[model samples]
Target: MKVSMQISFNLDIINKCVCHKCPVQNQSECVRTQMAGLKTSFREIPLNPHKIPKAYCLNGKSVCKGIDRSKPCICGSCEIYAKHQLSEAEPGGFYCIEGKSA
Candidate 1:
């Protein structure tokens, strides 16, 4: 049998994000810390609800194409990404674009 997966894209969580000042030294820990503070069920959605900062969202036309990937993506290790089944390739860097891990 094939395994099924649930995917979610929560703008509510994105809007409530507060990983800006986290000193966890990694995105995964930052996401874990942020999720610990939430009180919602965190259901799954189909779209990529994460938002990118206006400053870094400018890639001539796209919202995250201009980002410097060489800086290392913490999203891969982020708890939020794992919890929501989000991929880095879809949202790309969350720190510079999405205001951190939360």
Candidate 2:
């Protein structure tokens, strides 16, 4: 049987997220802008899911549409994915396109 858990939207999850490195988001200027924002004021501002470049699995659908869905998801390689048993979640890996895990 598959097991799953609710993912928390937190800095820890953000730190471990691999979505920033995903090929899907590699060409997205919007994602890049958000990454810059994250680097500068991640802790200063309350994190909004719409503003996060990565960790869409814990957050929700991405705000950027430039991401290419043809690429493979690297969630299987993320530390948070392993720790949270995200493989068992519905919609599995493409959280950017399929929305958050559940």
Candidate 3:
């Protein structure tokens, strides 16, 4: 199960994720702090949801607090959304709080 979860969290998914730019987590100090450390993350190994707070839809709901859900979710425009056909999924796109794209 861990292997499958890790496999789901890949460099390709991370690179394509727009969570870093999303307004939902814009004010999250935790996300910002993690984002700062991401400069060397691509070259490093062993990534987890908290280690790299991206691709929430694929990696599951966020562990960080203070996510502003009042803002609109842009998951529909995401490559991961399209690739996964997330339009039909429940909660549509707010994967950050709604959990993975179920």
Candidate 4:
């Protein structure tokens, strides 16, 4: 069995929460930073809680439920991959497992 919850808060929204990669139209580096952050954040979570929150990570690594190759991966060509020492043979591709390409 599974359960879901939705929480929303309104506080004079200021800056638009756009991904850094989306800003200035730097899709490559933006994705790398976002992915790296997601991987690191998830790894920081403790396992004792036994509850993981969803909708947090947005590194663009997640695949569709039934799809094998969801989107074209640019990790191989990304600069972050080389800067951060991420490998292509890792289990989770993109930003999920190994994290950013930069």
Leading candidate by lDDT: 2
What are the clashing pairs of model 2?
Answer: none
Q: Tell me how far the alpha carbon of residue 80 in candidate 4 is from the true structure, in angstroms, after superposition.
A: 1.0
Best by TM-score: 2
**TM-score per model over all chains:** 0.29, 0.87, 0.83, 0.26
| lDDT, each prediction | 0.36, 0.81, 0.76, 0.30
Model 4, span 1-102: residue lDDT tens: 121212221111101222222222233443344445654544553421111212211232322222223444344444433333345324323343333223
Worst 10 residues of 1 by lDDT: 53-62
Encode model 1's per-residue lDDT on 1-102: one tens digit a residue: 222223233454444333333332224443344345433323433422233221111121113233443455444554554554444334444445444222
Higher-TM-score candidate among 2 and 3? 2
User: Native-vs-model 3 lDDT?
Assistant: 0.76
Model 4 TM: 0.26
List ranges where model 1 is wrong by over 4 Å: 1-5, 12-62, 84-102
- Candidate 2 per-residue C-alpha lDDT over 1-97 given as tens digits, one digit per residue, 9 for 90 to 100: 4655566678888888888889998888988888888766576556677877888887768889799989988999999888878787687888898
lDDT of 1 at 44: 34
lDDT of 1 at 39: 36
lDDT of 3 by residue, 27-100 (tens): 88877888888877656677656668788877678888888999878777788777666777665678888987
- Flag the better candidate by TM-score, 2 or 4: 2
lDDT accuracy of residue 52 in candidate 1: 25
